[model samples]
Target: MAIVLGLRVLGIDFDDEERIERIESAFPAVSFVRLNGWTIAELHLECFPEKAFHEATDLIHQLGAYGELEFVEVVPHLVNTSDIAKLTGVTRQAVNKWVTHPDLGFPAETDFVGGGHARQKIWSLYTVNEWLSEVMGIDLGLELPPMNLVKQVDGYLALEGDPLLDGAKDFHASGL
Candidate 1:
């Protein structure tokens, strides 16, 4: 099974599997608190129980009354339209419009001068990476450009599909 742990948030994301050898390799007596939605069924939790051997039938109801001790998974933030687009070799117009849309995701930020002209638009790097991995199937890494530097262009920067746009359009909409 695949387990994604959030060290900072004290949470874990787990996928069911036949057996978790990694946990046994590290923790001999590790306990899996089976949580299906809000209810916790203590009966379903066996000490290092074989993944396939564990009873998954009615897991939510079988958990019984251990709601207070369950380890819940926290949701991670997502990368901005432009950042995700740049990382995925796509355009901001596509990222902002065709991809994440208005009600989802966030914007990028940099520590350089003249940044954050607005405050509510900043994004955490991990959140952005998490979103990319979940939505655009792009892995977030630290290999992005340092910011404030984009592809150079010439003449009036129209909002249409100019094909000559530097790169900021990755943040803005296309055909604006």
Candidate 2:
């Protein structure tokens, strides 16, 4: 089975038409979206879990050849009440009620955006899915990608550019 991973790439110029074409040509399978100005590219890829780290590293390295590779991370999906409602085909009021009812054991918001009246609560998609399955007894009829594997891949990738960890050997053997 293939797992989908989201990658956040920073310090790359998306305005250069030639560079964009080259990147798209080289990474045909990756879906890239420019977000928060021209410097960040959000890339989505579907690949075997075992190959995620290597594939992400190679892609980042290739992108680095074009510009500075400041940071790269495997980001998880975040959603709000409206997103939950849309995803589960329910009303936003229902989601809000679930959140407000303490007996429902709904997961707390992972983040908050804006302030006061405009504030919106955010939850990890995985967290919400688990709540739906275990608490609400609802199955969305789809398996979420293995988040543990994704997190491990993210951790391994984080060690890639750390100078202090240079020449590190056999992370698994070391029981890291």
Q: Write the per-residue lDDT of candidate 1 for residues 1-176, one digit (tens) a residue.
A: 32221211112333433233343333332334433232211222232323311222123212222221232222222345565667778877776564336565543443332356643233556556656677667775553321111111111113222555646453442212
Whole-model lDDT values for every prediction:
0.35, 0.69
Mark the 10 consecutive residues where model 1 has the least summed lDDT.
147-156
Candidate 1 global lDDT: 0.35
lDDT of 1 at 119: 31
Screening candidate 2 with a backbone cut-off below 3 angstroms (N, C-alpha, C), the clashing residue pairs are none
- The residue pairs that clash in candidate 1, if any, are 40-63, 41-62, 41-63, 41-64, 42-63, 77-127, 78-127, 78-128, 79-128, 92-170
Most TM-score-accurate candidate:
2
Identify the leading candidate in terms of lDDT: 2
User: Candidate 1, which segments miss by more than 4 Å at Cα?
Assistant: 1-81, 98-121, 141-176
